[model samples]
Target: MSDTPQSFENFKLNKQLLLAINEAGYEKPTPIQAQALPLALAGHDLLGIAQTGTGKTAAYLLPLLFKLKYAQGKHPRGLVLAPTRELVLQITDEVNRFAKYTDLRSVSLYGGVGPKSQIEALQEGVDLIISTPGRFLDLYNRGEIFTRDLKTMVMDEADKMLDMGFMPQIRSTLEVIPVKRQNMLFSATFSGRVEVLSQEFLEFPERVEVTPQATTAETIRQVKYAVPNLKTKIHLLEFLLRQQELKRVIVFTKSRKNAEAVSNYLGRRDLGEVKVIHANKGQNTRIHSMDLFKAGDVRILVATDVAARGLDITEVSHVINFDVPLIYDDYVHRIGRTGRAEKDGEAITFVNPAEAYHFDKIEGIIRMQVVELSLPEGVEVPPTPFVEKQEYEREIDLQKRKENPDFKGAFHEKKGNPGTNPFKPTEKKRGNKNSKAKKNRSQLKTQSKYKNK
Candidate 1:
């Protein structure tokens, strides 16, 4: 078995495996796969940097399955560490489908679900384990699973994993794994921290750079909208959905609360169908929502950044960003959920004044100016009043408190001394007033605490 070119026929893969690939309607290898597969199949460590939707999953998976098949190991021979449960499930789906003709048994382990099934899968001797860092480390520390037989280790979305503060967890796993084995790190971006982590893990690995890092999909028509507030966004979204006649849409938000809020707002406006999925939802709910959206049962699906990556649904006409993504790469992945398979799709982002700085970096990374799409005629939308809000009574009150020396919280002052007050009264009256103020302050603190809870 030697290096295989991009041609499917020349790869000389097992007939059944090739048939599965053909059945999947894949003819030629993607750039990442074409360049990295040969080296990976040769048991060489590799660092593959490519943007999303560039066939990254297949790039590492095909060679991994083939290598696992020939290596002949009774124990688990390969391990893949992903940052999120969705990504883990996505990768497991790819590997299981590609290995359908082979004898390899794979299992995916992640949180937000019970581990009894995962424990059982390990007991049955899985050859490949696709897992998130937390759940995998949990099982490892409990003495229920062993990494002694692990030969090939892959960190998918390596930059994201580190960005989400998974360094300690990843360090723990890396410290225990066998050092003299094949390693692969794949991500959409290459930051300095990612480069440092790669240097720490890989030993003179072959580097493969297919697309420019942090590049958005060229197939997608990127545009931005300047909206003032929530009400304007609602109106604009309704108008666009009507004009563009979006058959299916995925709206991305920054938080779970926003997902729910946007979904409810759209539903209240009598939008045909809407759903939301986030970590707060149970796995069954999330899966059901995705299935319904994929089958065209739902018209719009609102989601957070966690669901932005690894969604395989096609035919999504539009991806509207209800909230501009905090991370630039996340914006890329969110828009990638649409415009797949040679389809022309549109990505529209709502840029409030607060989020303008975020888009500046995003524009620089994509290397193209995001077209500024104007509002429809006579929309009567107002711009965000950030300057006026800063000059309001709230700011005056804050300044007064900071500048005045005698200003207490609407009561007694902590000035020179309580014993010698400017407005002296009877001793009993003073004690009573002080006690009343203290009691009121205590009650206020209690109310504040309870309200927050």
Candidate 2:
């Protein structure tokens, strides 16, 4: 072992793994690989704290491959868990690439489609398993997967898994696996929650932090625009896409509806083969969209947070946040899609009035203010509609109420004010009530006069 394994050869990896690494065009060890590989190769449970695109994948993969040189028995010896289907597929591809020269077999399991093929793959036998928590657990419960021979378990994007509320599944998976197996957890951000998870999962694990947690990549140039509303954001996005510098881009929206809207708008405008992906999209559709983007057939990809974690496309030139992520930590992951592997990239955020607060939180988390760029001259700056404005104000007030229980939001009005109740027809109801009262009084007076006569 060398003090600084500057090159891949310095690690003394297996010949087949080395050959595959070389063929994949990896010249030297990344900072994470240089630091973590030695410990991982020595069979220590590792807690690697490194952001996406820091070569963390290779840091763990190389050692695991080296230890499990070839396919052993029918059951898998190595298990890797990711948070998303895209990530599972990405990991599967990387596993195939790195294990090309060896006889190792890998299978990826995720829930969007039928599990028939996945069950078949598991039955046929594999050396490695890359999967999402739910699908893997589903198959396991059905007696489709056998984990008796599992020797290594790697949890990639551990923080995202926790954020996605997969802790129970992770725990259940842990219960079924052998307690004597090696455990490895890698995450971009090591928050308190992740630390707690590590305590339960790892045994005296060696902590490795290549970069500070919740920090954005220095290679990315971040900029922001304060648009009036969603329509203006769309206009500005179109204007930006017209610029030739934005060659390959991913536009991130907060909701599936927005993702589809942006993708359809770009497609209608002929903005260079736009494709949309979200939870609603079919499995094959999502895979095909990603394939098109990766192959350069599509210039733009519109996606929700599903694409924010563990998507490893290195050639992405730009990341546009069509809507600021409500969860501040997600901003880091969204921009991370670009600025990967020491590459220069740009991340532009479109902040509408409603999203400004969320954007501020993101800036606070990143510890840097994004340079506010003026809206392009040609783009139409429409006035925010009353409905949209009220919605924005309502959301802002809700957030404030969360921070301060005594705070009254914009939606709050005097308790007795009928006008404040939007759902009630105050004017119409009031007039009808007065007219009915007057008619009843006249009828009562006439009935009294008739009785006296």
Candidate 3:
């Protein structure tokens, strides 16, 4: 790690790997790859702190591939566990790319699909296996996977695995994999649990952190729209998407319902071909949508946080947060989808009044303010619906209680205010339910809201 190897040849990589990297147009190592490849080549257990688009995949893959030069056994000699199936498939693609010249073979294991084909692939013989922890353990329990030959084990996207509660399955995996093996854990952020697991299992790993945790790429220009309700947010989103600047966009929503709604809304309009992906979708459908987006057949891809991590789509022009992510860290990953390969990109977030508190927390983590833009003229934004306003107030109150245990919410009576509930809306805006419904809804009211870029 003293001075980064200026060229890939500095590591003395096998000729096959060199040829592959050359053909793939990778001449120099990225920051993460520069720091990580040497240590991995030296047979060190690696703990790499890197976000997506940092070439962390190749950082470990090169050395791991060198160790397993060619496929020699029926069982896998290298194993990688990722949090999601998309990530597993992505890593499998990298393994195949680097191992293309060599006789190396790999198979992907994940849920939402039958295991019969995966079992058949393993039976046909593979040098490497990339899988989600749950699917790996399921196959292992079924006596389909053989791990005695494993020489190296990697846990990619470790933070995500912890977030999704894969610690138990990971522990079970530790009990089964061979004792004498190299371990590597790469993640964007390290939680307490991830730190403890690395200490207990990784055995004094050579740690490499390429950037600050949760810090966004400088290549991404960020902005936010403060709107009153979901209905208005949709209107602004449609207006923005109509602009010619937004070529390839990924719209991130908080819920599967929202993803489908947004997809349906855009599908009925003049917005380009739109596709939505969530856990509820079948695996083939999700894969098909991803392929279409990557191939430029689909112009807009709507998704929940399920698509936030491990998606490697390149040249993404913008990432739009239709709903502010409740999990603060997800804001980073959602925007990370764009601004890859040092290309300039934009991140646009829609923050309702209820989500402003969470958005503030997100800013604190990223250490920068998202530029606040004024709403564009000619777009009609409706006022906040009473039912939706109630939901927002409830969410805000819940957030306050989560931040502080002794918080007396807005619904609770205050000492100085002699009232049962202190948060009653003005009668002019929120009249009786019947009267509110009878009024002609014209436009949404907002303090601020847009960027042409």
Candidate 4:
């Protein structure tokens, strides 16, 4: 319990884990690892509050590896649940890397692919099973996997799991697993939802906060550009990518359609081997794209929030937010992809008028104002189109209505006659009056003809 920052050796971790750690070039424990490792090793239910890339993975993995030094049974002794397939794979890779010196076997289970391989891996015997909740449940329900022997259950990125509406699955998982197992929950930001989730899952847990909640890494320089529309944002993106300093960039859009569109735009513009990844993409495609980006074969990777949480590429020089994430906490995870491992990086956000409200919320959550910069002089700043302008206005008005239910938005204002109720029957009544007058005229004409005869 020395106040001085100590090396990994001081943790008294398994020699095999120490060898792997040294080989991985990890000399000193990160703030999170140093604080959480001892408590976790001591078998405490832990609620660790720290952002991604804070070595939370290692914090949990190291202690778990020590406890399960070698593989013993066909059933998994360690279970790690993540929100996305990418995260499942990432955590699995970390396990493989750390447990290299041991006989421990681990497998990653996620959907979007055949389960035959996963079932086979489980059959062959795995000590650790890293998985998404759905695929794990699928396998468990099919009797292809068993978890009665699970000694440790780690919920990595627990906040994201809740954000993605995985609470029910997590609850189901809780019901299936042994109630006596150790529980560890890690999150970048601890929201009210996470607090409630922790209450249901964790015992009187040791609370570990490496930094203040929802705080962005100081290593990343954040800036924003108020582009007028999507087209302008694209032009701005192209302009920014032209700079030599912006190498190994990840452009995050809010939707799959935008991710693909951005990738196509960049590819057409010859912006150096662009790749796109979203839920729609095949599992192999996502994995290949990630590999290419990691190898520097792809210069820019355009992605949605699916890749926001657990991507561990350390050399990302820039993170461009083509669309401001509506979920403000996601903005923290997005920016976290860069400025990882204490490397200085940049996070640039393109905020159209429609997204300005979301951008403000992001600022509020991060507790710092992102410096708004004027668009680069040479870039063509296109005018916001009529459709986009209306959309932006409507979004703003909707947000206003949410805040003040009585406040009628601009879109709700009466466009025609102020005194007239558009939903009323004034037109129908006028039509009936005209018809009656025509009938009276017809009767009068008949009477005139009879008098003339």
Candidates in order, TM-scores: namely: 0.82, 0.94, 0.90, 0.92
Q: What is the lDDT of residue 15 in candidate 2?
A: 90
**Against the hidden true structure, what lDDT does model 3 obtain?**
0.89
Candidate lDDT scores, in order, read: 0.82, 0.90, 0.89, 0.91
lDDT of 2 by residue, 1-453 (tens): 336676788878889998899899888888889999989988999999987888889999999989899888899899999999999999888888999988888899998889998888888889899999999999999998899899999999999999999999999999999999888999999889899999999999998987888889999999999888878988899999999999999999999998888888899997798999999999899999999999999999999999998888989999999999988889999999999988999999998777888888888888889999998799988888887888888888878887899997656767787457743335657888999999999999999999999
| Model 2 TM-score on a 0 to 1 scale | 0.94
On the 0 to 100 scale, the lDDT of residue 324 in model 3 is 88
Give the alpha carbon lDDT tens digit for every residue of 99-197 in model 4: 989998988999999999999999999998899999999999999888799999999999999888999899999999999999999999888999999
Q: Model 2, residue 2: what's the lDDT?
A: 34
lDDT for model 2 comes to 0.90
Q: On residues 215-251, what C-alpha lDDT tens digit does candidate 3 reach at each position?
A: 8988899999888888889999999999999999999
Every model: Cα RMSD to truth: 10.1, 2.3, 12.5, 3.5
Instruction: Arrange candidates, best TM-score first.
Output: 2, 4, 3, 1
Which of the two, 2 or 3, has more TM-score? Answer: 2
- Least accurate stretch of 10 residues (summed lDDT) in model 2? 418-427
Model 1 steric clash pairs: none
